[model samples]
Target: MTNEAFQQLLQGGVVLLDGATGTNLQQAGMPIGVCPEQWILENRDVMIDLQRRFVEAGSQILYAPTFTGNRLKLAEYGLDDQLGAINQGLVAISKEAAQGKALVAGDMTMTGQQLYPMGELTFDGLVDVYREQAQALYDAGVDLFIVETMMSLQETRACVLAIKEVCDLPIMATLTFEKDGRTLYGTPPEAAVVVLQNLGVDAVGLNCSTGPADMVETVRKMYEYATIPLIAKPNAGLPELDGDKTVYKTTPEEFAQDGRLLIEAGAHIVGGCCGTTPDHIRALHEAVCRLTPKAPHASHHRVLASERQVVEIKLDGSFQVIGERINPTGKKKLQAELRAGKLDMVRAMAREQERNGASILDVNMGTNGIDEKEMMLKAIYEVTGVSGLPLSIDTSSPDIMEAALRIYPGRALVNSISCETEKRKKLLPVVKKYGAMFIALPVSDNGIPKTLEEKHAVLDELLADAYDHGFSPEDVVVDALVATVGAAPTSALDCMATFSHCKQDLGLATVCGLSNISFGLPDRIYVNATFLGMAIASGLTMAIANPSQDLLMNTAAAANMLMNKEGSDLAYIHRMQYFDKKEAERKRQEEAELLASHGTAGAVETAGESQDAEQGPVNPVYQAVLEGEKAAVVALAQQELAHCMAG
Candidate 1:
């Protein structure tokens, strides 16, 4: 009836949840391929009896049989319109069967479609699907919600986001894993822990992939990172084909033996999936009823995450440089291109930033004439499709932030929010709700903090606001309010002090708009590059700077080497050398083609190395990249560009 009630069952020790509703229902004379929800509605006694048996067998939490009632899942049977009635009816039957004895959880499951980038289901579309079911389930008087058998972590994230929009019921979610110990899309156990636990799911773990033996290993691995309670619902071992019927090999006793191991492995709740039965639950309950729950592992949450990777934020670690060159802020050419809806340049910039080792890309499409929200979303669409890199969404508008947040398929970092009460009150909730990281600029009503103490004061307030709104401290990436050196002679010193304060004093991840240090300074790249190294050595973990700046990039490479980033020096060498080799091969081909077309520059190579006595003069651009001579390449590229423009 209450979370307190549900939690009470867990506190007593391992809480036993009911076994497979689909498997039990099929065993009870339902026709193959018939709609389970409709059939259960018509035969309420059969549904009630099945659940009552689970309760009798010692299940403390009963999942209502609404797994396939979501609109998308039901649409396959042409019963999408019946979604509301089906979900409500199933919950009602579940509650009636529980009869105030066991906690009834409103069950949800995966739709057969994939999420965007993986499949066609848009994030908003997924939200709508889960929202409708959540509303109906809440109205039907369920105690909690369980999203089980999920295959994709993105879709599970959308479901949790949607359900949170309509209800605050404790959400216990689980993803089905493959034999390789990751989701088919490569979501590892740690990524799942990072995403779901941060979203505040009451419980999470594996389901439907393997039997007790495999699930125990997954649970043990999950325990290494999760601070929240973990659930385990394994199949009764793998199923096999026997004649025309499928059969699960693990006996009830063997399944129960595995359940005991799952409880010992730190799972708070143990249930069955796929081929489990009431007898299986009974045996599992008997086996684990006496075992005490183990204390959960400590949580580590300072990370910049995408759907596929979680980059930890650590000062001694490799710096996280979010490429800032994608913004159209002062880039007139890029702005003009965006205005014309030509995103070819945007895609090219994304590729370039990634190649330059930018860990995250900062996308800012805000300009005067065009709709910033529309352009921002459009640019995000193009960039995300082509780049695997995570995004740092730069926007000040609440509407745009929420719109982009909904459509963005992975966890993203918001460009900024400050200590201004109105903006904080408006946007922090959105950031919290979507589980996004945002740069908390140290700016109070006094304006951007000019002194280190003033910056600290603002950061303190921002942290309070974020915490009050349910954001973890790790989600607040500190910007430290970097100021231009020319604007204030002491600005560079003040900025470095605050940046250090953020990591050392606040124990938080730090980022900066590093270009600010070079603003109005002569030979800006030199100042920016030097300050970047200083910032990292002083505990700045991330920098928002132009990745295309060769000096800045070369400086970062050396900084990585100094910080002991694994293989950093060797990687830099290979990258430089590979470019040179490719350039040489390209030069050879270009010269051969030119000789065939316009006859050479009338020069011949050394006698032994001369190319077919008829070859044209060598193209130097090929030689530049081939030789890995960066200065030569830049000169050749500029020369080529000047010639093309003039001709």
Candidate 2:
């Protein structure tokens, strides 16, 4: 069926799907330990009869028993040579069973071969395997595609990408979550929803891990972030070992009762998995047919995700810091390490930044004397392994960006796209295709805009192009174009104005490089910290900055609290507690050193050193802000806002 028709079908009510192909076939005298696809094809009459019973029992969608038809899986049974015939025959059987009364979904799943960094199966190789099976299913004319019982989100992504490359069939994907609400691979249900929905899957959810009652919570977690329909094809219940066979104990009535809970929790589509039969599907249909389907989320959240974590970007939420130390631009140590083809430093930096409270990490590998694309892929693989923070793909090369996004196993944030005709033209489609949020730089082919109006014009042009490529305001974060305050005394003011404009006038999130305004200034940390506070007060959503700087980080936490952003009070208190502990440890080490020296002279010298430290020049305003002296900080914030408005 076409995507339009599929959507219309979902609008009618809960889309009922067929249940338990393999188990039901086993009950029909297809023996265990045999190839399911081969057995189904050999016993075509029985396959048709079972599916016909489902169609009669009110299954709106029937999955063709081609789940194991991929090249790798067929090779397991020495039926590799007959992959096409086996898949086509199964589809034909399912179609016959449907009798044009229900839709037939060409089902696919994992190849039982683990993907790379874990096993020998290359991602491209796996895609090719699925591509081969998808071709035969398309030729045989299945209505839509359903990839179910998946345990790996990346594997699901490979199948969806392969099928889209082959044909534009409506695709639905569901992963099986363990009892702890994560997949076997540690991917949580919400992360699965974010990753799959962004990859253009028409519907996404969990299947087969447990019964409907247990699956309801997972469905609810996904519903908060899902902008597409959710599918809940749960097993009949937890499996039980009965002699030599595994059985589910849930009766059709019990299964139906829990199926209603799935609907109430936001499952737009419902079905059964292992241990379910036509009776379960009929009971589910009877229980939920009249219940109003919960609509998908009204708008897509501005979110970035890794395999296990999601970082949401909200316009009025707590300020976020994108760790910027991963780039090798000015870091001699990092650049040297990258040239030697090592990611030890990259991994270390990822961990350090996460500890320093960075919401996202920016990874840029544009140094010389290395294959940038290769290093980028390696960095992505290494960093994701070490940290759960989502990456911001920062590269000037479109080729490197595409390669990273293709293999990087999460929703990334592109560092930038500009209005420089060729750059936007080449990269916009890649970003959209890979489902990445991007930093939209308001730079045209003419270069940085000289005036706020020119910057606005550049942004307008770029956003128009982005909209043409199907990006919404939530998918973009505008860069406020921070110029050096040393060069232009009003550059900071211009940036603050741009931040306000992006957030208030254009309805987009804004970010800036926090250190740009501090270039050529003495005590750069002071400048950076102060500008950060002003920027936050002016509506900046996030900043790319060095997260290890205590002054900058503490200023951010304090600023967030002063602004009364959501959850900032507890965040500020926790941040301060951590710092306090670190401070106490430092003093303990100092006392130990003093004791080791062991004299009144040593104590006098240490006291003098402390006195000297306290006598150093300080920025009282910035210090008061960091210390949470709310009266002074609030007054300064008000003054800064008044100045910003007056300017």
All predictions: root-mean-square deviation over Cα?
7.5, 11.4
For model 1, the superposed segments whose C-alpha errors exceed 4 Å read: 75-78, 113-122, 297-299, 563-647
Candidate 1 global lDDT: 0.81
What ranges in model 2 sit over 4 Å off? 585-647
- Quantify all predictions' global Cα lDDT against the true fold: 0.81, 0.90
lDDT of 2 by residue, 1-647 (tens): 78999999998989999989888887889887889988887789999999999998899999999988998888888999999999999999999999999999999999998888778888888889999999999999999999988998889889998998899989999999997889988898888888888889999988897999999899999999999999999899999999988899999999999999999999999999999999999999999999998999878999999988899999999999999989999889999999999877898799889888999999999988898999998888878877889999999999989989988788999999999999999999999998999999999999999998999999999999999999999999999989889999999999989889889998899999989998998989988999999999999999999888888989999999999999999999999898886677578668757776776677756765665586664555675554434346777777778888999
**TM-scores, one per candidate:** 0.85, 0.91
Q: How close is candidate 1 to the true structure, as a TM-score?
A: 0.85
lDDT of 1 by residue, 348-440 (tens): 798778877788999988888788898888788778766767889998898899898777756789889989888888899888767688898
